[model samples]
Target: MSLRAILLITLQQEPGTGYDILQRFKAGLAHVWQASHQQLYRELDRMRGDGLLTCETVPQAERPDRKVYHLTAAGGEALDTWLAEPLAAGPVREPLFAKFFAWERWPADARRRELGDLHEQLTQRLATYAAIEEEWFAAPERLTPAQRAPWHTLRLGQRLTQTWREWIEEVLEEGE
Candidate 1:
């Protein structure tokens, strides 16, 4: 999905300054999409220009003025339209896949070291997903409709990461 679509989704529930939106991205949307600070501000500016979003300048007591963005009617419609459209899978460009494709170029010991590092990274990612599940979705049956959507997305991520971790384990064992 495009960053524009992601921004629209984020601003739908509430109005937020750029910083506020970035914070939410880190906590909520990082798995779906990631953008740098500059990229976010640039997209926000473009959305404002397109009349999909409205920005207001708010003055703080001791800080520089901040701009808060609110989704306009057009923005909501755009989100709805995009949501209804069939989602095509985006391109998967994984560097590790390339590395493995040329596996004979590397020594066995080096390959083992790289696999070990990758395994650790995936392990950490799984731990993070588990913690998020524990804290946010401990009782899925009790969640509101709004909350259920995100919980399902989290579950999808967990299963995908788990599959990758399992494969990595098998490959590592084979090399051992």
Candidate 2:
């Protein structure tokens, strides 16, 4: 999905400043979609020009004015139409998987180091997912209808991370 669609989805949850949207992406959407601050700001401008979003300038003390965004009716329609379309499975583009595919070419020590690094990264990621899950469970009432969809995606991320960690452990054991 285009970043525009993702931003629309976010705004549908609530009107927010660019920073707020960025935080939302960092907090949850990073699992599936990622955008740098510059990319998001540029897209916000484009989406505004496309008439899919409306922006409000709010004055701030000791800071520049803040621009808050809200999805327009057109944006809602665009999002709904996109959601109705059937989605095709995209090609896997994992760099780590690519490295594994060429493991035979790497020196033995390099392979071990790479595997160790991946294992460490995956372990840290799983811990983060666990924390998020715990927070959600602790405040079930805070989850809104809009959050339910992303919550399911978060569960998928947790499961996938767990599976990846298991596979990494098996590979490490095999290398022993």
Q: Which segments of candidate 1 are over 4 A away from where they belong? A: none
Tens-digit lDDT track for model 1 on 16-129? 999999988877777667899999999999999999999999998999999999999999999999999999887988888887877788788988888889888878988888
Candidate 2 local lDDT, 29-85, one digit each (tens) = 777788889999999999999999999999999999999998999989988998899
User: Estimated TM-score per prediction?
Assistant: 0.92, 0.87
Q: Whole-model lDDT, candidate 2? A: 0.84
Number of the top lDDT candidate: 1
Q: Which window of ten consecutive residues has the lowest lDDT sum in model 1?
A: 25-34
